[model samples]
Target: MKKLIPISIAILFIAVIILFVMQCNVSKECAAPAGKAETPAIRADGTDLTIAYINTDTLLLNYQLSRDLNEELLKKQEDARTNLNQEARAFESEMQEFQRKLENNGFLSRDRAEREQQRLINREQELKDLNAKLSNELMVRQQEISSQLLDSITIYLKEMNLDKDYDLILSTTVGGTILHAKDGLNITGEVLDALNNRYKKKK
Candidate 1:
């Protein structure tokens, strides 16, 4: 089976991460200078604008829900492939039998031979349709799983932020624009740990 997960799904998580981070910053007016102080950036309403970033690629890899979903999807794809292969083998056998009948004039009449040919064509079409349908269904399910994982991350961020009082929690990819930050600003490990812990409780 081809890669069950799409890179677009990772991009989708990036988009969702950005949106949630924006929500955290939306109420704040502006940012403070880098390395200004340990204190968070202050909002016009006297709120702190503590900002941190997570490595999204790392998060996706370590995130328990994502791992679980990936395994499940892989299994589903393998099963689908096995079933399709079986169907293909059966179709090939029938096709060979049809060819043999044609060559030996086993059909009682020309009309019967043509009818068998049409039937084989129709069966082949059905198998093709089935394969396409199964593939499409799996794709849809993968998308749903991706969205669900994003929702899980978003919810966990909200809960964690409530206690941590962060104003913005950004997610960065390996080669994203966020080039440098102090070790203190990287919250990926903490977030991944929390996410896994929460997932464990749920399971």
Candidate 2:
């Protein structure tokens, strides 16, 4: 009776193995034929749909309006600089004449020379302060304009998001940092197109 029981257990084990092999074969048949399985687009985590990259080219294209804005701002700055330079030169010339008058015949009176020196020093300080104030004010104005333009860019980004259904948007231009990518991962062109559309609408 013991021998029969052992033989029965061995037969059951063999039957189980055979059934498992048959089921595996059936699964194989249900799936793709050998070596023809469809590859999954994503991993088990369910990512890797579509991603894009943009670079300096994308930014320049998307925000070309900034170029014109900068040009205008620079023109104003240059004009201001030119006018300030003219004023500085005039002040310097007047100081030179005053010094010449104070040191008549190459011999300056001690009291008169000292007074002229103090006036020149005060004028120099005034000129320095004016230059500093103008430079700071211009810098502030530039920053304000830049902030405004960036707000416009954000508005355009929102508009483009509504227009296109992109899984990921990226940049690779000189200023944009992109560490990795594959083929068709660049959406710089798409963003540029959207910016162009926005420009057109503004017109």
Prediction-by-prediction clash tally: 0, 6
lDDT of each: 0.75, 0.52
Q: Candidate 2 regions off by >4 Å?
A: 1-45, 105-112, 179-183, 200-203
Best by TM-score: 1
lDDT per residue (tens digit) for residues 1-203 in model 2:
00101111111111111001111122223233345334223222333333445553445534556555666667666766776787688887978787687657443577866777787788878777777766666666666665655556556555665555444444344443556667576665665666666776886
Task: Give per-model TM-scores.
Answer: 0.81, 0.63
Tell me the tens digit of each residue's lDDT in model 1 across 87-127: 88898999999999999989999999999899989998888
Alpha-carbon RMSD of each model: 4.9, 26.6
Worst 10 residues of 1 by lDDT: 1-10
